[model samples]
Target chain A: MHRIVAFFLKQYPFFLFLLLEIVAISLVINHNNYHKGVLRLGVSEVSGTTYEIWSHITGYFSLHQQNRALAEENARLRSQMPDAFKASDRKVFVRDDTVYQQQFEYVSARVVKSSVNRQRNILMIDKGVNQGIAQNMGVMGSDGIVGVVQSVSANYALVLPVINVGANIFARLKSNDQKGIVSWNGASYHYAQMKGIPGHILVEQGDTIITSGQSVFFPEGLCVGFVTDYVQSPGDNFYTIRLRLGVDFNSLNHVYVIRNLMADEQHNLLKENGDAE
Target chain B: MQNSPMLHIGRFAALGFTQILVLNNVQFGGYLNPYIYILFILLLPLRTPPLVMILSGFAMGMFIDLFTGMMGLHTAATLFVAFYRKRIMKVVIGVREEDYLGTPGIRDLGPWRFFYYAGAATLTHHLLVYMLEVFTFINFWSVMLRTLANSMVSVVFIMVAMVLFERRRHG
Candidate 1:
């Protein structure tokens, strides 16, 4: 007992360091499974509020650019409006609304805080549970698919972006519908690698990659990126295709969170089929 | 040079805010993130108790973590800087900490020695941070490159800040 006491007395600093490190590591490990507890609430709320205020102050700096982008998107959307099309004499028929029920809904949210330099990048947006935001919803910028919602607080939601090493976005070639998984290689924010493309298929530069409507997160044909280059190693069946992502994560501001209305129904049907098999 | 806790506390808040708000946002080539917050740990009084140093490091790291949502990464890395700080200081300064007066900075150790001191400390901190963040050795070269590049940027930033700080003190 005396020896132990003396040893501790001599090495208290090391012990203290070890103890604190363990606590920190445990916090990291448990942070993933964390529900909306008091500590998380407090931290998220404070950080969320601070980021909102800061973004508001900084938001003015880029008002002109943002307005231009918004105007361009508005122009593009306006061209798709039903009223924009003139009356046609050749058997024009209105599509029945009941035949095409809305499967996806979008909630517009302003990004409060975002980081792209890290291996695992997360963005915080102003809308949260109060605005009908939930886990696993897909997020998209004006240009392309952004990320998926990982967690949500009452007033904010955290988005796990495509640039993160942990995120995998299923994308396909716009020309031939060749499917592949787009994943970040922890190298650059401007690019990601598309894997699982067969070597036999010829991939060219400037080939557009869009989200494959397979996942419940993103809708079909949302722009993901463009193929910049690809290489097929000898004896390898897969081509390692490099792509330039459409969304510029560094200057990401406003985004739309996509909530699939039929997600639960599709998921339940899939699960039931799997269980039966 | 002031031994007051208030001085340290003020430095803590100032550096912490600078790191979280400004430095974290400043990224070059999407690879370099200059972490000047560790400057707080590096500039602590030489005679500060090891326990105080460790606790302060942990507190500062947690404070940054709360804002960034990276709970353990900063805490673990900054704790290492705190733990090895004295040894690095002793190596660079070639003197027992007890014999030294005032916080170590560009003014006290001159620009070159301060650079070496801050460089070693930030390198150690950034290496641990990037390694732990990647959590793999598969891309060891990229990790090393990031560490070296970011450490250089951070050390340069620290040197410039210390120079400005010394100028202010003198004026």
Candidate 2:
């Protein structure tokens, strides 16, 4: 026993390091299965309070740029709605009245904390659950999809921005109508990977990537980014296409949290179908 | 033993905050951000408890994981490096720590010895982090390449920081 103690005492730092790492790995393995406890309401309340304080401080510096971006986006949306009315674009494709567009209900929030330099970056939004922002809602700015809400507090929400490792969204090519998972490659905040795209489909640079709208988060046709590069794996059935997310996470602020009015119904329906299938 | 624990904790937290706030914000060449948390393993107290050291590393990794959202990649990498830190210490420093003050650095291990120890640990940590971050889901070639290149850059920074820190502490 004395010999054992002496040996361990000599290598204690080494042993301690291993012990900590084991615990962390255990958490990572269990994280994907962490559905029950994570969905509670308190996280959102904490988020709301923090967002309010941070936004109050950074709001001044970001106001002008945010306003200009909002104005431009509004102008663009207005032009598109009128165009959709005159042309048959809106009528032909959007007959599924189930889709609700309540962009007007968006609450703008500033970003006081963000991480783009790491392989997994998260954005801290100044508005949280108290601001009517809830988890799983889509977050966007003037350009396009920024992220989805991960957790929320009364005054703050933690946004897992597109640059994060776990940031996966269902996106489709506008011209080709192919959909797949869009994930970050941990590089080029300007670009990310879109996998599971059928290799047989035609791909072009500058092809627009838009939300598939199947996630019950972002509405369909919300601009995501453009395909910058694509390659077909040998002997594989899918193409790995790279997309540039529209929102620059580096300059995130004043994002609109999209609340789908029918999300609860849609979620329940999906759950029912999932069980049945 | 008492002062060593405090020393390690304070330095760990300080390094953790810097990596999260400042280093995470600095981006250059479109896709390169040096991993600074390797410093935690690179500077563990020489004669500290192995269990405590690993726990500190895991805590640091979890601290990083909470912020960046990589699920568990940082945790995996930090754990791996912490596991190997002793081998690195033995090979680089050629001595088991006896009465070393705080963590092992140039002040404690001298310039040449500190470089070898810090370099080996930092490189191993960066390579593991990149691999785990892109593991099982992403492409292999890209992750491997990024891991190698990134490890090189971060190792350079760790070397410089050790030299500077030692000079300031001793000189």
Candidate 3:
């Protein structure tokens, strides 16, 4: 303690010098706007940067909750899209009766399990019959079509995404009215084949393909992909077109299960026609 | 030798008033204001304690800042000069034991030695004052120019004041 006291007494001048300098600097910063602005900016910048780092650190721990919230928000927004309505014209018109009827509803679900490299890729979502998720409903992501619900349990549902070999979606060219059936051939997750486009349809390399409303699973104009390449062989009846799949399967997270209100009516009509014939 | 505290206090009041009233208004060509108040720090007795010297420097600077509103620039520069005055004295007059005991004036140390000692201190004070006033090195050359021009006039005024007041001691 004695030696420590002596050491401090020897360094008293330096301590005094520092104290006086601090006083002077505070006075300068307090009185001068320019110095005050610079000091405030430096202090806030340091603190703001530290706060951002802390937020990122805490953010990693709550990723599951954040993903759930995001999925719910996406579902709410997807249900409001024009394609979710059955009306062809979007213009608002006042009528005695309701002019627009909601034809589609969406339930938010998370992909709890998935695979891409397999021939029969399947996705399991966290929502099942408890969340109104039923089999054969269309599942779409924010970017494009994902798949149809294959089966459901009490709290989980299985999905067959577009990359699966058994999956097929009726897709049409956006530029022209040419329609084709999109399917996977167990080759690559990035590419899918669109079959039955006739040869003289003037297909281009970059034509955007979207879902045709004729199918009950997916709504009209739901994006499938852009035509990366297309070729027609001699005496062939149709064009062999390859498409870059819109939804990236490797990073699939949240999906919306589209519930078509008219699906039962359409299917019953078709079944009755088949039985009569 | 130590001067009486009353005498130093009187000097402080007189010099501070004159600086705020007369010399501060004596700006020529908007660049040539003389700061003669620094002489308080320069003319302090060599035997004065370093702490007293530094505090007196700060008080005198704060007094001037109150009137001129330059806000801490004068205090910082004056404190700097006061802190380094002992080293400057040793450099001007050799490190003799008796040299530390005398007052610094043209009579105690010859005119040339005193001039050099006071001139260096005044130049340092002026450079610091102007640099702190500008607060940035973007106008470094102009700050240097102003410091040199102002220091020349201030040194001349200080020397003339010294000769006038201490002429009897010189004889």
Best by TM-score: 1
Number of colliding residue pairs in each model: 0, 34, 0
Every model's TM-score: 0.95, 0.75, 0.44
Model 2 agreement with the true structure over A1-277: per-residue lDDT tens digits: 9999999989776566556666666555554332322532344344345444545765677779778877887888887884656555745665444685453356787776775765656677777766898878898878888988877776677777888777788998899778898998676787889998888898999999999977878988878899889998789899998887788877776688888888887778878889521
Count of backbone collisions in candidate 2: 34
Candidate 2 CAPRI-style tier: acceptable
Question: Residue by residue across A1-277, what tens digits does model 3's lDDT show?
Answer: 9999999888776566567656765665464432222222223233333333443554576688668857876687889986687775657634443667778898877765555643455666677777887778999987789999876666666677898766889999999979989998655778999999998899888889999887888889999999999988888899989999988776666788999988888889989889421
- Computed on C-alpha atoms, the DockQ of candidate 2 is 0.36
- Best-to-worst DockQ order: 1, 2, 3
- Predicted candidate 2 versus true structure: per-residue lDDT over B21-106, tens digit per residue: 55665676646677777787777766666666567667787777665545566888887777667777777667754526555776
Candidate No. with top lDDT: 1
CAPRI class of candidate 3: incorrect
Query: Where in model 2 is the C-alpha error above 4 Å?
Result: A1-19, A32-104, A117-120, A164-168, A175-187, A194-204, A229-240, A273-277, B1-10, B38-41, B49-55, B69-84, B96-103, B135-141, B167-171
Candidate 3 segments whose C-alpha is farther than 4 A from its true place = A34-277, B92-95
Q: Judging by DockQ against the true structure, name the best candidate.
A: 1
lDDT-best of 1 and 2: 1
Per-residue C-alpha lDDT of model 1 across residues A172-220, encoded as one tens digit per residue: 9999999999999988999999999999898899999999999989999
